[model samples]
Target chain A: MTDSGFKKLVLSHFWVAFGAFGVASVLGLYQVVERSGLIPALQSPKVYFASVSTHGVLMAYVLTTFFVMGFGYLVAVSSLKTPLWNPKLAWVGFGVSAFGTALAAIPLLTGRGSVLYTFYPPLQASALLYIGAALLVIGSWFWCVIMLVMYGQWKKGHPGETVPLPMFANTANAILWLWTSAGVALEVVFQLIPWSLGLMDTVDVGLARTLFAWTLHPIVYFWLIPAYIALYSFVPQAAGGKLFSHELGRVAFIMLLILSLPIGFHHLYMDPQQGKGFKLAHGVGTFLVALPTLITGFTISASLEKAGRQAGGTGLFGWIGTLPWRDPMVLAAILAFGMLIAGGFGGIVNASYAMNAMIHNTAWVPGHFHLIFAGTTVILYMAIAYYVWPSLTGRTLVSRTLPVIQLWTWFIGMTILTTPWHILGLLGQPRRISSVVYNSVLTLAWTPYELAMIVGGAILLGSALLFLYILWKSQTAGAPEANAEIRYAGYEEPETPVPVLLNDFKLWNRIILALMLVNFGYPIAQFFFTKTFGSIGWGY
Target chain B: MSNLIPVHPLEKRWIYVVLGVIALFLGAIFYTALVHQVHPPGAIETIDSATLHLGGEFAEDKLGVRTDADGHLRATLVAARYGFYPREIRVPEGLPITFRIASADVLHGMHVPMTNLDTMVVPGYVSTVTTTFPKPGEYPMLCNEYCGMGHDHMWSKVIVVSRESWKAAAPQTGR
Candidate 1:
C-alpha cells in the first residue's frame, strides 16, 4: 500500500475528494441559512440565487464529480490490479478540474453570472463561467480516456480473461460520463459560449434546451455510479452476504450506462421547444432507465435482507432490524438507502408523464432531488470518507459517535424538510419564490411547511458542522495508527460469466449510437429546418 | 479445466418465477399506459342547455371537466372575477362525474380533490378539465394558478348534490 504504483494514484484522488467535500459542506450551511429567509439581512434574491446556484453546482457537480473520480481510481488500481495507464495525465485532469472550479466560483460568488446553477440559455453567465465549466468537463474527459486505456491495457495484458467487476462498473461510469457530458458540453460550447462571449447575436432557446436535454438527466447517473459500485461491490459483503449475483450488478451498470441518456427529454416535458413526439420517445426511455434502478434496489435490498437474516432476524421482512446499525458505513447506507426508496418513489411519480404536471416547477422538484443527492448520495460519500480517512491518513477517526449522529440527523432533517416541500408543491407553492408574505389561505398553508423547513435546515447545518469537525479533528488530533490497511468485505466473485452483453461494451456502444440517432436526429433537425422565434438576445 | 463454475445459485429456479411475474405485470401495465397515452383524442362534447351548468367538481378520482351544449361551464367557482355556479350538479355516493371545463377569458388553473380534477382553462381555446367528486361536503374550487387583478377573489364552490336533488334539478327543470 506504499505510495509507489497503484496506491499513489488512489491516494491522490481521495485527497481531492475529501478536500472538496469539506469546503462544500461549509458553503452548504451558509446556503441553507440564507435560503431560509429567516435572516432578513441575508435575503437578497440575487445573492440567494447565486449562492443557491453555486451551492448546488458545487455539491451536485463539483463535489460529486471529484469524489466519484477518486473512488474510480481506487477501483481501477486495486480491482484491475494494474497501474493507472497514465498517472501524469490523471494528475493533469485533476489540475484542470480544480482550476475550472476556481474560475467558475468567481462569477458565481460575485453575482456576475447569477443564471442559477442550471445554465439554461437566455440568461447567460460570464464567459469565464462557461469556459471554467467546459474545462472541468474536459478534465473529466481525460479521466474517461485514462479509464478506457486502463481497461483496454488490462484486457491486452491478460488475453481471454474477464474484466474485474469493479473496473467493469468503473469503466461503465466513465463511458456514461463521456456520453452524459456531451449534451451539455455541446450546449455550453456552442450556445452558451457564443452567447456569453457576445459572438452570437441571437441564440436559439429551443436548440439550447434540446442540447442540454441530452446532458440533464443522464448526468445524474454520473453522480450515482460510485454509489452503485459501492452497492454492488462493497455493501453486500459488508452486510455479511455474498455478492448477490455479480451478473445482476453488471447488468445494472450496463443498463444504467446505456439507458440514462436519450431520455433526458423527461426534463423537457413541460417545455414547448421539444415536441410531444420527442417527449414521448424520451418518456419511454425514462421508464426503461428505471429498470436498472429497480434491479439495484431489489438486489441491494435483498442483499441487506439476507445479511439481516443471517444475523438472526426472523420473518419475511423482519430481518431489517438484525443488521448492525452502529457501524458508520452500515448506518449511513441504511439511512441513505431509505432516502433512495422515498426519493426513487417520488421520481416514479414525477416521470408519470401526466402526473408530472402536479409537481413541475414546484418546490417538490428540489425537494425530491435534495432527498436523492444530498440525503442518499452525499451521506454515502460521507460514509466513504469516514471509511477511507483512517486508512488513507493513518489516523483514527475522531468522534465515531458524531459521524453516526451526523448521518442520522442529516437523514431526519432531509425527510422533514422535503415531505412538506412535496405537500407545498401540491398546495401551489412555486419552486423559486424568494419569500411568502401573505396571511391568507394559500399563504397560510405554506407557513407550517416553511416553519418545518427552518427546523430541518438547522438540523442539517448542525450535522454539517459535526461532519467537518470530525474530519478536521481526525486530520489534527486523532492518534497515529500506522500499518492502517484498506479493507473490503469477504465476498466471493461469482464464477458465472455475465452474458457478453453485460460485460461487452462493444454492443452497448453500437446500441447507444443507434438510439441517439433516432431520439435526437429529427428533434435537433427541426431547429435547423424551421425558422425560430426569439425575443431577447442572449443575455450575458 | 476451462469449464467455468456457475455463480452462486447459477440456475435460480425461484428467481425465474418471481421475475417472470414481475416482467409480465410490468409489460402489461407499460403497454396499457402507452396505449392510453397514444390513443387519438376522443372528443366527446357535452350538450349544455343551461345558462350556467356545473362543470368539473373538485374531487379525487378523475381529471378535467365535462360540459353540456349551451357552452357555459357546468361548474362551480368559490369566487370569480367572483362567482360559483348553482350548487346542484350532484352525483350519488361513490359515483364520479366528468368535469368538462373551459375558460371564457384569461388562464385559470383549477383543482378539486374530492373529484381529483386538475387542469387549466385558456381563453377562446376550449380547455377541457375533468374530475370526479367523491366527498359530499362543499370543497373550495381553488385557483392554483394566479390569473387577474382580482385573483384573490377567484374562487368557486362545489355543492356535491345527491342523486335525488340532481334529478329534481335535471335539465328538464330549466331552472
Candidate 2:
C-alpha cells in the first residue's frame, strides 16, 4: 500500500469510530440528565432504560471495538512495515459490524431492549438486540482473523526477527480477545440467542453468568491493550525518549494476555450461581492479574522517568516535571495513568471477593467502569485521533490547545462524577433508580451526592462537544501543507538477534494453555458436580 | 529537596518545587487511607438471647409496647407491596424490646433509620429488628427498598406514648 493509502484505511476506521463516539456522547449527556431524576418531564423509565442500553452499547461495544480494530490495522501496517494482508476483508468486517450496530439500535432506541446492558438471566430484551450484538461480535472476529493472518505473514517474512513492538503488542491483544471472547461468544450463541428466540425450553442463568464473567474481565484488557500499547511504544517516543526495555515490554504484554484470561472469575464474586471453589479460584486468579498491572505501573512510570531524564530531569520523581505535558499524546498518557490509579484501585476492591459484597450491583459498578474506560482508555484513543488527524488529512491540527482542554475536562468530570458515585454505592444507593423519593433519612442522604453528579455530567457534556469540534476542524480546516509522519524516538531498532522464545510466541501460547489448564481446569468442571441450578426463563 | 541532583540543560529549580507539591498531594491520600477507619454498614447490635421477640404481621397486630424513660413506648412499622397491616408500631423510650417483624406480603428491609440498622424481613421468615427508642418524636418508618406499587405509601408512625397510658392500653389492646 502507498503511504497515504494505509492512512486512509486507518482514518476510515477512525471516522466510523468518531461518528459513533460523537453520537454516543450526545446519548451519554442525555443519559446523565435522564437518570438524575431532577427533571420529572425527562424521567420516563422506558425512555431512561432505552437511552442507557443504547448509550452503553454504543460506547462500550461500538466505539471501543471500531477504534481498536482501526488502530490495529494501522499499527500493523505501519509498525510492521508491511502491507495489510486483506484490505477487502477488513472493510467487510467494518461493514458487518456497522450493519450489526444499526440493527441493534432499532431495538434499543425503541425502548424494547431495556433489560439493562448486562447478560443477566430472566431479564431479556428483544431478540434483535441479542442477535445484533452477536453479529457485532462476529464482525469483530473477522477483524481478529485478519489481525492474526497479518501477524503470521509478518513472522513468515522475517524469520527469527523480533516483530515490531506495535505489531507484537497488537497481536498479543488479538490473541487475548480470541481466547477471552470464547466464553461470552458461546453464551450468546448457545444460551441467549436461542432463549431470546423462544427456541430453547429454558436457560440456565447461573451458567450464563459464569460464562459471561469469563468474557467480562478479559474484555477490559481488550479495550485497554491499545491504550497500553500507546503507553509503551508511542508515549515515550512522543516524549522524545527511547523505550526503556523491549524485553520488559514483551513480558508485560504476555503476562497481560495470560493473566487477563484466567482472572475472568473476579466478576463472579457476588454471583450466587457460581460456587465458592470457583469464586475462590477466580479470586486468587484476580490477585495474579494485579501483578501485570503493577508491572505495567512500574514499567510505564520508569519509561516516563526515562523520558523526563532525557529532557534533563534529575532526582527521583523530579524528572516527572521535565516530561512534555503539552504534547497531546504525552498528556493523554499522563492523564490516563492518573485515572488508572483511581480506577484500577477500585477494580482491585471489586475483585476482592470479600469486598464484592460492599459494592455489588451498586452505583459503584458504573463508577469504576466509567473512570477506567471513559477516563483512561477513551482519552488515549482520542490522543491517537488527535495525532493521526493531521497526518491522514494532510493538514495541521486546528487547535493544539483544545485537545488538552478536552483531556483535562474529561479527567475532572470523571473524578467529580464517580467519586461520589462510589460513596453513593456505599451509602446504599442502588443503581437504575431515577429517584430516591421515599424521603427517609437514607434517601435524604443521597441528595447532595446526586446534585454533584449533575454538575460533573454538565462539564463532561461540554467537553465532549469541544472534542467533536477539534476533530471536525482538523478534518476540514488547518494548514493543508502540514503532514509529516513521525518515527519512534528517531532510533532504528538496534540491529540484534534475539532468542526466538524472547522475541516470539512459539512457546508462550503453550505455556499460557498449560497455565490456564492448571488455573481454570477444575473451576469450570465443578459446575457439573454441583447441584444442577434451576433454569430461569427469559425476563423482560 | 537536598537530593535534587543536578542533571540537565534548561532544568529549572522551580519545576522541582512543583513536583514536590504533587508528591505531597499524593502522599496525603496514602496517609488518609492508612490512618482512616472504614465503617461499612451492618448490624451494630446483636440479640443472641430470646430477650427480643420478632414475629409476623399477624403477631405484630396483637403486639404490645414495653415502657422506657419518661414512660414512653415506640415500634417500627414496615411497608411492603401488599396493603399495610400492623402499619402502626408501639415503642417504649429507653426500653429495649424484641420486635417480632414479618412482612404481610413481599420481602423488605426492616430498617431503623437513625441507627443505620436494618435486617431483611421475609414474609414467612418473620424477620425482626430490636432497638430501644432513645428519644421520642413521631419517628416515621418507611419501606426504602422496592417491593412494588404503594412502596412509597408503605410507612407507619411510631408514637412513643407515656408508660402509664401504654400500660393501660397494653392490657386492653392485648385483650
Candidate 3:
C-alpha cells in the first residue's frame, strides 16, 4: 500500500519535526538550569531569552505544523486508499517550509529574534523572523489545500458514502487551520512585518493583541485534533477493541471546530482593549469548548472498557488489568489521558473569568500548556510514529521495550516538571525570567521548586534522546517486517450511514463565520474607530 | 437524525452531565461578576506610550499613591523596559486602592504576590485594577510578563501600612 514517493514525503516531514523537537528539548534543559540560579556560569538573561524564544518557535510552530502535515498526508493516503493528490506540489510545500525554517533559525540563533513566540509588540524582533514565520505558515496553507482537495475528490467519487473517520477528522483540522492561521497571518503581514521593517513608525498594540487572541485559542485545537484522531481512530484498535461510538467521534470533532474559534477572547481577559461584555461572552464560549473533551474522555474510556471485558475480564475493576499494557500505543493513551485530566483542571482555572487573574502570565500558564502540548499532544505523536513507522519504513521497530520505557519516562518527567511549576506560580513566581533577583523571603521559597524543575527537565531530555534514537535505529538498521499494513479501529456496531450534517462541514463553516463576526467584529472595529495610540518599535 | 445514528443511552446521559458541569461553572462566574462586582481589569483607557514620561499622570513626580478629591486612594505608576516607576509605594490597608498603570515602552505585567492585583500594562493602554488589601504588610510587586533582558530585575515593593499610620504619615501630594 506504500508508494515509495509518498513514503519518502511522510518521512521527510517527520524528520524535520523530530529534528526540531530534539533541539528544542536541549534548549528546554538549558533554560531550566539557567533559570535555577544555581549554575552561576550559565545565567545570562540575553542568552536565556534568546533560547526561550527559539525553543518556543521550534516546539509550538515548527514541530506541530510539520508533524500534523505529515500525519495528515499518511492518513489521507492509507485510509482513503488513494494516491496523494499532486505529489509534486506536496514536495514543493515541504521545500518551502524547510527553507523557511532555516531562514528563521538564523535570526533565532543570532539573538536578533528573541521576541518570544507570542512576540507581543512593540517589543520587536528582526523582520526576517516574521517573514520566515509567514512563509512557514504559507507553506502549510498548501497542505490545507491538498487535504481539502482530496476530501472533495473522494466525496465526488463515492457519493453519500461515509468518509474514513481519520480522514474526516483530518479534513476538519485542515479547515480549522485555515480559519485559525488567518488571525496571526493578518497580524504578521500587516502589522508585525511592517513595523519591524521600519515601514511603519508605530503599531496599535491593542489591535495586534486582539488579532493574536483570534489565533491564540483555536490554534490549540489545531494541534490537539490530531491527538484526538489518534485517540479515537488508533488507540481503540491498538487496545484490541473496537471504537465505542463512531457518531460521537464526528460530533466531537465538529463541536471542537465551531466552539474553539469564538472563545479566543478568554486569552484577552486581562487586557484593557476589550470590554467586559465581550470578555464574558468569550468566557462562556471557552467553557462550551470543554464539552467535546469531556465527551472524548467518556467515549474513549467506554471503548477501553468494552475491549477489556471482551478479553475475558469479569469483575468491575478487572477490565483495567486485562487490556494490553505493554503495547506502546495503549500505554501512551493511558499516560496521555492522565496528563490531560491534570492539564484540563488547570485549563478550567484559566477559563474562569475571575480566577484567570490568579495565574495569568505566571509560571502556571507554562505549566498548564506544557502538560497539554508537550505531554499529551507530543507524546501521542510519538506513539503514532511508533505505530506507523513499520508501515512507512518497511522495518520493524528496533526495540519494543525501549518505546514502553520511553513513554513512561516522558510521562513521569512531565509530571515532575509541571507539578512544581504550578506551585511556583501559586507562590507568585513569574514566568520568562532568567533569575529571581528579589532576594526577599518569598523569593527564597521558590528555590526548591526551581531545583525540582531542573531534575524534571534532565529526565525529559534523556527521554527525548531515547525516542529519537529508537526512530533512527529502526529506520536505518532494523530488519523489514512483512505484512506491515496500516489499519484503523473498527466500530463496535456496524457504522450506519451518518446524516449529511454530521458527514459534511458546510453548515459548520457558516456557523463559524457568523460566530467570529459576532464575537470579534466590534472588538476589532472599535480599535479603528476609537482614539488609540500606537507605539514605536523597541528592542531588548 | 436520531434514526440515522442513535446515540448510546449511557453516552446520552453523559452529555447531560457535561452540560450541567459547564452550567455550574458559568453560574459561579456570573454570580461573582454580577453580585460581587469582581471582574477582570478591563479599563479601556488609551495613552501615548512613547511620550508618556514627558508630562502626564505617569510623570516622574506624579506617580505613587495619592488621595483624590473624593477622599479615595489611587496609585499611578509607569512601567518600562526595566522597572516600575517610584520602585516602591506605601498604601493603607482595608481600603479600596485603584491602580492605574501605563507602560512607557513595550508591554509589561504587574502582580503583587498573594493578591488579585495582576494585569498586563500594554504600551498604548492603561490597565486599571482596583482591590482592597486586607492584610497590612510588605509585599513584593513582581513583573510577571517578559519585558526585556532586564525582566527578572523588574520588580518593586509595596508597603501596606495600617489606615491610622497612613493618616499620620505625610499627606499624599497629588490630587
Candidate 4:
C-alpha cells in the first residue's frame, strides 16, 4: 500500500506502452481493410505504406520498449524488495522515449517515413524518424543500466543467495537487450542518421541489412523474455500451484540470452550480403535457441498440470479440464502456448538453410511473426497487465469477464488473421504490397484470404479497444482492493542450492562475446575489406 | 550456497526429445545444403547500384536470358523502382537457369511462386540463384520486398516454354 511511488512509475510507462498499442491497433485494422482492396476509397499506396510503417514502429518499437522497461522496474522493486535504483533517472528515460515517439510521429503521419519498420537502405525516410528511433533506443539503455545496477546491488547485499527468479530473468533480459540493441544502434548512429540527413552521400545497404539482421532476430527475444518472465514468475502461483522447477527457469533464461544473440543471420538467409557458411552457422544457432523454449514449455506445462491435479483433477488429461480457465493469466498462458506451437513450427521452416526460400519475404513471414510476437507475446503482456492492475492501481478490476472475453477474441482474431496470411504466402503472394493490382490468377486466389484478414483485423481492433477500456476503467472507476499484493510462483519442492554460474551472468557474457565475434566479426568486417559501393538515398 | 539442483528425470527426458527434434531438422538442412546443393542465395558479389545500367553485365541490352560460355543459360536482370528489366523473359523448361539480379535503385526481393528461387536484390550487391523450371508455364515473378510507391506493380513474367520450341526459335542462343 505504501508503494504508491512505484505504482505511479509503473503505470506511467504502461500507459505510454498501451497508448502506442491502441493507436497501432487502429492502423493495423485500416491496413488490413485497405490492403484487401475492398474499399475503393481507402486505396492509396502512400497512405497504406505510411500506415504500415507507423503501425510497425508503434507496436514493435514503442510498445515493446516501454512495456519491458516498465515491467522490469516492477520486477526489480517487487522481487528484490528494494526501492528503484534511480527513480529520477527512470522518469528521465521515460520522458526521452516519449518525446522521441512524438517527434517520430511527425514524419510517420505525414507519409514521409513510409519506409517500413525495417527501413532497409538505400530507401530513406525523414532523418527525424531515424533520430527519434535512436533516442528511443538510447532511453531504453537507461532502463537497462538501472536493471543491471539493481541486480548487481541485490547480489552484493545477499551474497551466495539465489537472485529472485523474476529479477534474474528481468536482468537477463536487460543484458540481452543491451546486446541486441547495439547492432541497430550502430547502424542508426553511424549509417542511417547521417545518410538520411544528407551528410553521407551513399550508404552500404548490405552492411545496413547485416546490422539489422543482427538486431532483428534477437529483438524478438527481447520482447519475448518478459512474457516468459510472466509465465515463470506468475502463472503457477496464479493457478494455485507452485513452480515445477526453478532451476529450469533460470537455465531457460540463460539459454535465451546466449543463443539468441549470434543467430540473426537466419533473417538474411536469402540476401546476397553474407556467405553460405555464416548463414548456415547462424541457422544452427537459431535452432539452438528453440531448445530453451521447449524446456520452458515442458516446465510450465508440468507446473500447470500440478496445479490442476492439486485442484482435485485425476487421470492424464483430466488435469487440463480442472485448470482454472477463468483465471486470466492461466487462459493467456494456454492460448499463448497454443500460438507458440504454431508460430514455432513456421519459425523452424524459416530458419532452415535451404527451406527459407519458399517463404522468405512472403506473407508467411508476417504471419509467423504476428503469431509469435503479437499473438503469443502480446497476449501474455495483456495477462500480466490484468494481473498487476489491482496492485499497481490499488483498485479491483472493473470487469473480469471483459478481460477473459478480450483474451479469447485476441486469440481467435489472430488465428483468423494469420491463417489466410500463411495461405497467401504459399500462394506466392508477396508481403508489403499496397493492393492486389497484379490481377493474375495467383493473386486472385489471395482475395478470399485478404477478406478473411480484414474480418480478423476488425475483431482484433475491437479486442484492443476493449483491453484499453478495461485498463482505463480499472484505473479510474474500479472499487478499492485492500489486499492487492503481488505474489510470484514458489517452487514445489524445498529450495535447492543454486550454482554461481546459473545465478550470475559473467561467464555467459564472456561466452556471448566470443560467439558474437565468431559469428559476426568476419561477416561484418568483410564489408569493409571488400570493394563495396554504397548507394545514395532514394525516396519512396 | 548449495549445489545446483539435478534436472528432474521427466524434464531430462523431455530435453532429449527436444534435442532430437532439433537434430532432425538440422540433419535435413545439412543434407539439402550439402548433398543436393540447395542453399539460400548468399552471393557476395558487389556492384555500383547507381551506375549499373550505364554499362557492363546489367546493361539494358544485356538484360534477359542468354547462353553463357559454359553453354548454361543465365538470366541477367535489373530491379528498378517500379519493375524488373525486360518485364518478361523466355527460358527453356527443365533446364537449370542461373539468375544474376541486382537492384538499380533501392532494395527489392524476387520470388517466383511455388519455386525455391527467391533472393533479395540488394542495391549494391548481386543476388544469384539457380533453379530449374520443370513445367512449362508463364510464372509471375513478383518483387516480394517493398521498394517504393510503385512496389505493388513491380512484377514481371518468366515464360517457360518447351525446350524443343525454345531451341528451334533461337538456335544460335540455345545450347
Cα displacement (Å) at residue A136, model 4: 0.4
Question: Which stretches in model 1 have alpha-carbon errors above 4 Å?
Answer: A4-37, A314-318, A437-440, A489-499, A538-540, B1-175
Candidate 1 CAPRI level:
incorrect
- Every candidate's DockQ is 0.06, 0.06, 0.84, 0.87
lDDT of 2 by residue, B66-168 (tens): 3345543333343345333455555545665555454444434444444333444433233444455667655555444334323334555565656566556
Candidate 2 lDDT, tens digit per residue, A250-269?
A: 66688788777777766654
Of models 1 and 2, which has the larger TM-score?
1
Query: What lDDT score is found at residue A340 in candidate 1?
Result: 90
Q: How close is candidate 3 to the true structure, as a TM-score?
A: 0.99
Best model per DockQ: 4
Off by over 4 Å in 2: A1-5, A489-495, A515-539, B1-175
- Writing each residue's lDDT as its tens digit, candidate 1 over A153-268 gives 89888766778678898899899898889988988888888877878755666677678879889888899888777777677776777666666677778889888978887775
- In candidate 2, how many Å is residue A329 off? 0.9
Full-model lDDT for every candidate: 0.67, 0.67, 0.92, 0.92
Say what the RMSD of model 4 is.
Answer: 1.5
Ten-residue segment with the worst summed lDDT in candidate 3 chain A? Answer: A493-502
